[model samples]
Target: MIIAEQKPIQEIKAMIAGYQKVLIVGCDTCVTICMAGGRKEVGIIASCLRMALQIDRKKPQLIEDCIQRQCEWEFVDTLKDKVDGVDAILSSACGVGVQALAERFPNKPVYPALNTTFMGMPNEHGLWVENCRGCGNCGLGRFGGICPIARCSKGLLNGPCGGSQNGKCEVSKEMDCGWQLIYGRLKTLNQLDQLEDILLPKDWSTDRDKGQRKMFRGDVYYEQTV
Candidate 1:
């Protein structure tokens, strides 16, 4: 999942202080799972903004709403009429969602209330750890399911660097060496032979840098939609 964390309240307040009317938009997808831009977090932020404005003698009108997703135009269209009177939009979604909202509502100033972190998975009750870099190419087949491009400190394509010590990354004691983990996992599965296969340089051009990557299925298309 794309993990993100909410921006500081002070920073968020500064972004929309000039506007008397603002919309606090939330996303119910990736951000929700990370507990950053979910419906509950949106309400808390809205209430806090109201209280802060009251204390500052600022009569700002704040409205809170959560959409199924802000990355898609269909979901953002739901706010067209509802956001008619708002001066600005404060998006609690990830960077992609913020940009999507901005693109959809070019006339309105859109502000991001969170910093998009990374592609990660939940490690514990409230902790999410980075996993993948979403590099245009994936080589998990040769690495025993561990992605060194993301987990490795140097994004190494080969085995662990000389810095690895006791199965831990040399960059930090807290981090486990990605290559080491791969070796151990491959050994456990009795597929250590896969380790001998060297990966070729990744073709990053095939990823997002090649320009917005997209996929379409003609089978799912309808004549009317076309």
Candidate 2:
């Protein structure tokens, strides 16, 4: 999931300082799970803005709404009429959501209310840890299900660096050495010999860094379009 965090109240206020009317848009997907941008979060932010504007003796018109997804046109289209009267839009969704709104409503000014963090999973009820970097190629098969590209600080493909000590990484005491975890996992599976196979250096060009990434499923494409 794409993990994100809401921007500070002060910063958000500043962004809409000049606008007399504003719309707070939220997404019900990834950002919602992270408690960053969702219907609940949208209400909180809207109320906060209302109070803040009142304190400033400014009657700012604030409207709040949440969509099933801000990345899809169908979801965003629902706001067409509501957005028409708003001076600006404050997107509480992920970066993609903010951009999608901007693209959909070219004339309206759109601002981000959260900082897009990373692709992560909830480690617990309130904690989320980074999982994937969205590297174009995946090598989980070779690494015992551990992702060296994202878990390792240096994204080393071969093995643990000298910085690993007792399964922990030198970069941070809280982080487990990704390669160490791979080794242990493979050892437990009686597949430790796989480690002997040196992995070739990653071809980064094939990954996200190359450019905008896209995937197409012909069946789904036609069905959705139709």
Query: What are the lDDT figures for the candidates, one per model?
Result: 0.90, 0.93
lDDT of 2 by residue, 75-165 (tens): 9999999999999999999999999999999999999999999999999999999989888788899999999988999899889899999
User: lDDT tens digits, residues 118-159, model 1?
Assistant: 999999989899999888678888788999889889988868
Question: Which candidate has the highest lDDT of all?
Answer: 2
Q: Estimate each model's TM-score.
A: 0.92, 0.94
Candidate 2 has a TM-score of: 0.94
Model 1: lDDT to the true structure: 0.90
